[model samples]
Target: MSSPDRCPVVHFDHHSPEHAADPVGAYRKLRAEHPVAWTEAHGGYWVLSDYESVFEAARDDYTFSSARTSYGGEGLSVTIPKTPMHLHIPIEIDPPDFRKYRKLVNLITAPAAVERMLDMISHYTTWFIDRVIEAGEADFAEIIGVPSIVTIDWLGLPVEEWSRYSSAHRATLSAVADSPEFRQAVEVDLPYLSKQMWEVIAERRLNPADDVISFLVQQQVDDRPLTDEEVFAIVDLLISGGVGTTASLVGQTLVWLYQNPDVRLRIKDDPGLLDRAIEEFLRYFSPTQALARTVTKDVEFRGCPMRTGDRVLLAWGSANRDEAGGFENPDALDIDRWPNRHTAFGVGLHRCAGSHLGRAMARSLIGQILERMPDYEIDLDGLVPYARQGVNIGFHKIPARFTPGPRRLPRDDRSG
Candidate 1:
């Protein structure tokens, strides 16, 4: 499998453990060793990791485009085709077209809106902890994970059925991701999830309330309300995006803290320092790993040639960790890391809309957990079974045990 001209390695299989264990390692190697590498695996595509190359891909929609079409008029399976849910989401669109939807999304997810939900956020954080804090140890996923479903579902989703939707979400990504097994899993679950969303959308329409669903059920766009299908499309994105991604961040970040007591101590002593720490965590431990795009025109990026019709995975995890990539130390978690531009929520036109809410939920949940029960380290073994996979990097399980009695956290101060 000869790659395009001026390329380096020809990775034979995309699902190799080497690719799985440390995805960024492969990308870094590509950036350093093969700035314009091509992989013949998974129906063929290109990997662009050079800092300059990715930046170009993000900005130049004409050369490195977001639309799922190619100037070459070829149907390359390089990128996953957009779904119905994408139509209502400006996140999947580009520029002016994306703005119409993004403005509404931003309005609802604005920082001020986050402040308004502080009481609910605080209450949930405390409520979840109060349930399992006494047990001395509990699975953060099940306790907090299940609760997220409840909170989000009340926001106008049928989240009580997460036991079902969670499986569906995992399966759909698994299908398109690294394995044939996951693809089979998707076959059995995706339709069910879609159907459930349809049913719930219908129910919410007939009977509206003060929740987010009602807000949408009657929301007007230029004096006309959204269609049921459009409403479901947007809500579906939230269903998959909101709860699952936050759970992953909370679980993974906890595990990271558990491994580094020094870091944990830093959080324990200066609770206020948590806000900055959470930002750095999102940068270093970006939950969303990669987003794919179909190249729409011929272009040369980072000095490597790109074809008109090809698939490119903007491996964010790799970009965030790149040593030469103009951010702070990509490898370490510096609580005071400022001017951080890691693309955890992505860059350019498709930036994540739910990010404010995501950060708020994660910060509040993690802060409250350590605030009340500071000495518990996480359990990684149990998470193996239910941890879902997708572009969003996440964990399936996190078990933490309190070190018994009045857990001591770092006080108002600690040396950085």
Candidate 2:
């Protein structure tokens, strides 16, 4: 019968350098001692550290609504200090209406549709690797980041401006809470990006094509085509969702493989194990660490009372390591670990639509690296992590040196 006034309180900052350096370790400690501790940071929010709590909360979206409006009706605030942004399409919307927007985007991001992009993913990966294969040394982030944006470019959006979009998109992800950089990106970069999307949307309206933008422009919701604002919101969702995270996964996993040569050797020796390895890496080091959900109604969860509109952070990284959550040796990285129901891509209605695309990109990038740079070794001393780490955990720089190789793909093979 613990009440909100009596529950244990902890001083935990997800963006702190200590947590950024090793979030798993932080979660391991929290889950053991204070599985549902209340934190004072970002205006006081409950942090669910154990798998059961996070999983249950995520499943019961009604109780813990994903609506960003729960905060102040400003926009989809997934973080504390609430970044000044607009609605992020389906993610910021609740069920019923949420499904409408999701259905439209899902047409392209579905597993079958994503599978069709494998060839293009391979081509993009080859294009990126070709740029660095001969240099012997390269920043893995740059190598992976550009191609990821380009892949999304092919999905719809102007390919000519992939670099600009990629830079702004990455900046938006890595920006700190209310920092100058974050403010600039939110105020400047996001609007600019949205305007670019609007241009594409306008173009698609006049001349439809076999791309996401065209589909969005023509897709009807409840017997009517989506409005301009709706189209822009969907584009915002897709662009933000498409970039950054996959690149983070590829870059982070490459660093992990380099650190653990035995695991690297095993994967290199048996390429069939790559899929499992990717899953294991995802569980071990979740890129999208935590997401915020607003309480829909007052309720008691695990002896703690929650009021409506209260914000809670679903620690996906912590849940992945929760032993009681069906994972054995939760801390250990077992590429072959079966029945691994990790929440790396989250769960319930709001599960990531671009998950399949993300996996394809990761697999493609990893395969390309292993094939072309089998002996690539990361400069451990040069590795740098992103400054802010609440939502996304990734490396800013991962410099590696490998035996030089010849380019296999032609430069003109850019378009899939």
| Candidate 2 structure lDDT | 0.81
Cα lDDT tens digits, model 2, 216-321, are 7888998988998898877777777778888888888999888888988888888899998788888888878998888888899998877777778899989999
The TM-score between candidate 1 and the true structure equals: 0.84
The local lDDT score (0 to 100) that residue 91 gets in candidate 2 is 85
Candidate 1, overall lDDT?
0.64
Query: How many clashes (backbone atoms < 3 Å, residues ≥3 apart in a chain or on different chains) does model 2 have?
Result: 0
Which ranges of candidate 1 are over 4 A from the true structure? Answer: 1-6, 12-15, 68-88, 144-147, 174-189, 221-223, 379-390, 403-416
CA lDDT of every candidate:
0.64, 0.81
**lDDT at position 10, candidate 2:** 83
Q: Pick the candidate with the highest lDDT.
A: 2
Question: What are the runs in model 2 whose C-alpha is more than 4 Å off?
Answer: 1-6, 70-73, 178-180, 411-416
